[model samples]
Target: MSEQLAEERASARPIPGQVGGRAVMLIPRRDPGTDESMLPPDYQRIIAAVRQAAGPVMAREVGEGVGVDVSVKAKLEPLRGKLVRLVDRGWLQKLPDGRFTTRL
Candidate 1:
């Protein structure tokens, strides 16, 4: 049982809360390097949509706003990852319900 593995396993444990009939857990991400700049245009667009919303914005909503069909999970998955990275970078806040909002 490596320390890192233990830590990850612990994090995977479910937390208490119900949103849309699903349990929600909020986990922060490890920070990436500071020198990293320049996000893709789509990432920027997603962030902008959340900021404009001025509240929690779901991934599906972001996809819809960006003219991408959220029904296609494959196309939506990459945007979700980018959203998580943006949250880690402090440009956005990821809510426990898998929604996001811009950081003030």
Candidate 2:
């Protein structure tokens, strides 16, 4: 019985923000009426940080809000990737100058 249950669980569909049992770090493109709650906690924070900015923001500035180590190039790269992903997904916009802002 236990083995059956385990097998069933293993075969279940992957959860949102996951694919093939690995967590997806990037947010999906925003659907027509969807909200931030549909995003992973970290992605939600990224959106909130951009929304709260007084103007378009640099990735390093956003990193500060998301608790990343802004001074570390490696740490900032992933955050930048997430920011770019958000831009690609329509949740944020990338200014020509390379800063980011909320789409709304």
Candidate 3:
């Protein structure tokens, strides 16, 4: 067998009870199903926070409140990107005033 094929096969396994499931795992697309998709756990938490706020909240507020350092120049900035994705995915709405709120 080709080394590449052997590696792929070795990395795949049947789920505990999903023998009928797809044999090859699929990586999610970067921008999939924005209109009718479920938010990831972290995004859900951010939205919950926005919902609890007095009004729409800034990305940094939500990011820091959710435990992300968010130091403008952080070596690896993830929270802000997640927030942007949440907006892009329709899980959150960005106001003209530059804040985020749960989509109606």
Candidate 4:
């Protein structure tokens, strides 16, 4: 092989997140709605529900408060994920009773 061609082939490196020779792009997870604000857009309903509640509220109530009558899991799953994110960010907390409340 030509020296230049050999060098070019040697310098070529595989991209990350690839498995089994498939191109899988891996991105760090982040809340898209939290770009410029403390609260993410996706969790606005959740926050509203918690804020409107008399006290710390259950996840079910928050899911219902999102206007979801059925498929509560659909609502709760993303809400739960966002809540975890918020908690990690120090803006919310999960109570011992599996409820949520805002820190600020």
Candidate topping TM-score? 2
1 or 3: which has the higher TM-score? 1
How far residue 21's Cα lies from its native spot in candidate 3, in Å, is 23
lDDT for each residue of candidate 1 in 1-103, tens digit (9 for 90 to 100): 6777656654553245778999744433334422112444566677677767756988888888888889999989877887887788677888888889876
**What order do you get sorting by TM-score, best first?**
2, 1, 3, 4
| Winner on lDDT (1 vs 2) | 2
Model 3 lDDT per residue over 35-65, tens place: 2223445656777778888888887778667
Per candidate, the number of residue pairs that clash is 0, 0, 0, 0
TM-score of 4: 0.54
Question: How does each model score on lDDT?
Answer: 0.68, 0.81, 0.61, 0.61
The lDDT leader among the candidates is 2
Distance from true location, Cα of 47 in model 3, Å: 1.3
* Candidate 3 global Cα RMSD: 12.5
Taking all chains together, the TM-score of candidate 3 against the true structure is: 0.55
User: What is the C-alpha lDDT profile of model 2 across 1-104, one tens digit per residue?
Assistant: 97787665445432457679987654556756556766777888998998888999999999998899988899999889888887888888999999999876
- Clash count for candidate 1 is 0
